[model samples]
Target: MSPEPTVEQLIAAARAGATGDDELALLDAVIAVTKDLSSHADEAVDQVVRQVRAAGHSWTVIGERLGVSRQAARQRYADRVERIREAAATGSVIHGRDLESSLSSALAAARADGLAEAGTEHLLLGLLTDGVAAATLEQLGATRDKIREASHRLFEHPTDWPGGGVPVFSAEAEAALAAARQLANERTPDCAPIIVNTPQLLAVIATNPGSRARRVLNHLGVDVADIKRLLHCYINVPRTPFGRRSRRGRGGKKQRDRCSFCGHPRSEERRLVAGPDVWICAECVALCAEMLAQPADGGV
Candidate 1:
């Protein structure tokens, strides 16, 4: 029936060791839970900071924690982080607590499915949840069917061997997805969807080294540069073309080069000319007559 102790009274009691053992145990439990929650909160904070930094945060702070100079951390993680962030931010709401939960769930799912490092397909699953990034992906035509197909190709093909040959997820891959989720979540309405463009998609597949996804993407004639650009914009990172130095002079100077199929800069790898002024890429030529065979929009 007595009134509860006031703040000053409680302070005085604590100083005097006047609290009962049962009350102290309860307080200790509460303190323990608080510490656990604080630990979790710290992890969440670290994840967000790491994601943003990967998208191109300077290393002065990152280095200070690692006991290294800013330049050292930058050199160590700049490209690796940028690539990981780019991959993750592709049209998904993957940030803050949402990103952490999604990534943790994804890793769990991959493990349950007996998969190695979390792939793009796994990332797609993370995006299936109801969120801003998922909405963006849906709006931009990233359907479950396409994702499933992509995943199948990535997992089944002999060429799609994951790096390191480890059965567990790679830290890099997980971090990439986390960064991407954060970037996707952070995007504004005016931002474009981070769907990989044809060329860019092709490049991702190709650069995957031995990934089946890379092979499939290449077969589809997607562009690597476009995919990278989409990812860069989505992740809010500076866009820098990979292998730009190698691509230089691989095809002659830009002005003189002509597309064999259309006489434009965007050349199809395979070309055919049915007649003069009837040039087309092999795929286009095959589809041309079928498209022409269809009734016009205004036809009865």
Candidate 2:
């Protein structure tokens, strides 16, 4: 049997401009294999890198095409390629052709059904097959019935399809996903799956009353505060609380500071300087002073 091409060999070939028609054909084959494994474009590129290395493409040429130095390309993709190989060897849940087929079929079903968005419902349905995600869902106590109940609550009405319409991206879905992507990009630019999932969609709905999406999010244990944080991070929109003072500074005036304990705004009371970061009204100060004068444990 022929010896496998070393990383050094691949880098040398790529740098030497020796990747001719035969090499290109080999690269194309690798690309095709990778595409068969994943519908994502990035994964295709990853597969090409692996194939080129296997076919003796040099890291220098690979890095050149990838817009990175040979060292950088190797550092970034070498471990990933190794992981892919390891996964293939270990019969991991996420590896093999079966999982890919399941994803493709599930996506196809959602598309054929005319779903406008790909939510957790679609993902769950897709996971009905024996895949890594499915295993994770099962371990997480996600059953079809639970998912159905959550979906119904999310939609605010029981229906056969909780996530309605073709799985194609919708303006609303795209906006949400874009917002998530922007936030993720700020934090981790190379993050995958820029789209928001059903869990996120539901959480947003739950935070905002009368939001179908929020209901879904609530059902999934994503509370209003979490949603608010996500919105703050991604949408740049603060979640204003009901009956709370606005944070926006009004003309040159300091924003109204409220008492942490009583929820009383500074405008409502006579200011008493208790301590640094501890402003209290005269009435509250008196009350606290009186309470302090009593026995440490007998104020009740």
Candidate 3:
């Protein structure tokens, strides 16, 4: 691919297009540079802030240089700064494509609802429609309609929600993201450079008692215990040593290989012990024995 145009080159082109009275050319140049600048603005600012702080600059001094109050500066950069530090303390990481899409949908959902910020509830609401988490959520009875009713009931909002700039993530939402990173690491240690996928993100949010996501799930009368146990099976294909599951046989008939107790699916040729209402797959019996051993409290 060709090298990206430099800022100076972009400015020159924009100026030339404007001076030449070519409206279309000018719009193109300006729009291209604006896209690049807007997309990378946060990272660039964070790097600069870190460099100056490392050089022993005080918040007041930095604020003075940036023409903003110290409190304003802290409020603007603190979450991202802390998250970056936290990530370094853990390991290199990033959101997988699926997770990214879910988050984007989360923001879109918040905007559509007329909310100013995307909270954990919004994150859960966003997952109701699409991505890897959708199937599990559907199985748990968290359809789009039900979640919308729950959220609307839990947090009442004005019907005429106003428009705004990009929505900021709530503190709980940020914590859920951090939690997702941790879960992703545990899910795939052998796999280097962990990528946080949809299932991991959903697991973290659903398990966090302090998050609104969990509250929404509870309001919807979901079985959180079942979700947690089932989330283990969605980690990754490499983690599922139970073997590949074949959904079809010679006659093209359907086959069932799911573990009834833990809801562990994606298995192949695994023997399942049939019960009155539930069947336990071989893998679940072997791996989830201890969990099954616990008191059947929480309806486990």
Candidate 4:
């Protein structure tokens, strides 16, 4: 593959794209391009650093790889890591592609109705686009048209309001989004990254009392609790393994005593039963036995 354009090449291109004989304009354009490049570079480095950190690398090792001092590396990236960690804890990481599409659809729905702002009802309608939210709503007989109609009838519309400008989210919609992010963060396992997908958003919208979304669902004769209950079926929050450790042995060597099922090291308290090419720990064996003991009809 060819190399990416250098800063000089990008600046030259920016200058070449300038119109008339305007030195200030050309300089501004070059500066803008430079700033943009710098921002993109910072973002790229931050993302790579985050991935490296996630992969269990320390500041000393990362600093060595970057040809910098450990303290310098930590000082540069530690704040960014802390910011990300705080955001994750507070459920601010809600920029998933699916959720973005739903937000777009929500704005479109608001615009279609000539509404000045996209309300939580519009967000609920948008969740019908795809994913677990759509399937769950469909199962509950909450079609897009039905929701739109119900929202139209239930929510208030301004009589003299002009909807020419882009529709911003209503306060309730914003609250719903925040709630969804919190729900997703809370439901996600510690081992997994938090993501505010359609299901989470939809559940928040449906469950929030006095919201336009909930009102619309009520108008359509659909129970809000049903949305929550149905969503639980689609959400899987895996538990963190007890006493889980690396599959590697001392000095980063591969361990043969690791259980093939859970990848946990075999300890004195938890011995492993070995087969031809697989190993099962005592916990996994007990789990398997319990599962097998269940009747064919799910023990009902």
Candidate 5:
């Protein structure tokens, strides 16, 4: 065996492996990736803010920990923390007629299925009955009747769900509602004070595969992954004036070969629906179909 390694020798060996310009380059790359991680961890930061607030830390103290002034802390995070703490903060957001109908239907679905509280499942079933949302779900194979039937079989009913008071939302349902608000905010920065519509909520739910609503969707043979992909294009991907993100302007007019509403090409979208200028593909048509369907019954 070699002579017993001295501490200084070990230190020198260890430092040599992770030192010099090569190591510095590696460190720089790690720093870049870490910045990306921090940007993506906004939700984690929000959660931690809630935790510290729940522990009764004042803004001043939290600010000190965050290396900011108390006012900065309060301004940056207090309202958001308050919203998470209060259910009514989220519930108070103005909802349209379609939203009102959806909520009422959600409550009704729970009542019909004999569930104690209206969980995300009922909310999803409610969405499946709503105009735009129903159309959006239809693309994922979650038809109104299929999802409704599946919701019934997802859980055994308790006879003692009680008949008197209004159906309250479960914790999970409330979380999903809050997430809907967040998703709407993320998608529409220009539209300040966005009150989520039914389609927006459905967009959020379709991607949340871990939720009870998604499980019910799974039972109905709905392709959750495909729903997620379509909604990502529908809600998250930026649309050009011609409806395709990759499209460019020549003579201030669309020149790209993709749909103005969805990035799908002419092949994926067979019909190639067009307006005065912009065109929407066949796939995206399913999401906005209720724009046509609903006005006929005003609820179709």
Candidate 6:
């Protein structure tokens, strides 16, 4: 697929399309794209700051790098960084890179609309930012533009706040994130920090019946249950005996057992049932059974 248009490209396109009568619309488009650019810049900073902090660098060092005083650096990012730390500290949840990017996109979407809080709809939009969630949504016929339009139509937008502070995640958005962390944690081995990925976040958001995100997805004719099942199947690959620790098979040869039908590797949740020179995961078996259960006249 072609790369998304850059902010400059979008702005040029907007200017080119402007007619005298539609100057206001053109201006709005410029504002939107610029806000997107700003949001991306902020996200980049946030990610880098988090990484620097994680590397045990002090705020003083960070401030020096950014050409600011330590106090100023702390004042600007302390709350956001601390909030993220607190959330992960509780469950030992680590945000994967894609999750972080998706969240940044979600926050950007909310900020672009001048919302005071990023809610479930924003989370849904964030899930489409990239990664497995984006691919899954695409397969289900939900595009970013479609979701954005439906969200704008179905959701209410509050007036822009007086100050241009970064928007906080709404309670529902926080809960959804927390739920995703828990789900990831559940699938992990004991004592290992759980890394929340985009698929996990998307699954939690899609499964929440009362969430605006789920409502928007439903509005676009995407089935939440199907999403849940599909994500589960993707996540629940059968675990190999090696189990991410050992690469060597018998006699120091590397071996990997995967589902013959679906080709998914082994995972904790889904076990493989072995056959002669082949293997099948539980998910694929269940899928095959379901397909076979259908009547001949009713195609799978």
**Index of the highest-TM-score prediction:** 6
Instruction: Give the per-residue lDDT of model 6 (tens digit) for 1-300.
Output: 111221223333344444532434444334433333332234335434664577677888777656689999899888766655565456567676667898999999999877989998998888877656876888788888988899999988767556588988999999999898777766543423355678778988888889999889989999887787666643542233321233347889976777644556788976987743556678766654453233332221
Q: Tell me the spans in candidate 4 whose CA falls farther than 4 Å from its real position.
A: 1-92, 158-161, 235-300
Q: For model 2, how does the per-residue alpha-carbon lDDT over 29-89 read when each residue is reduced to its tens digit? A: 4433333222223444664566677778888877776668999989988987766556435
Prediction RMSDs, each to the true structure: 23.9, 21.1, 20.3, 18.0, 20.9, 17.5
On residues 83-183, what C-alpha lDDT tens digit does candidate 5 reach at each position?
54453334345353455688789988887777668988888878765545665676666766887777667777777756776778888888888887666
* Window of ten residues with lowest summed lDDT in model 1: 1-10
| Alpha carbon lDDT of each predicted model | 0.39, 0.43, 0.60, 0.63, 0.56, 0.65
**lDDT (10s digit) by residue, model 4, range 60-149:** 877775668999989999887666566656645635555677799999988888887899989988887655577678888989989987
TM-score of each: 0.29, 0.30, 0.50, 0.51, 0.51, 0.52
lDDT-based ranking: 6, 4, 3, 5, 2, 1
How many angstroms is residue 152 displaced in model 2 relative to the true structure, after the best TM-score fit? 3.3
Q: What number of backbone clashes does candidate 4 have, counting pairs of residues 3 or more apart or in separate chains?
A: 0
For model 3, give the 10-residue run with minimal summed lDDT. 1-10
- Put down candidate 1 lDDT per residue, 151-193, tens digits, no spaces: 6655653344453433444554544444443333333222322
Highest lDDT against the true fold, candidate = 6
Better TM-score candidate (2, 5): 5
TM-score of 6: 0.52
- Candidate 3 regions exceeding 4 Å error are 1-90, 236-300
Assess candidate 1 and give its lDDT: 0.39
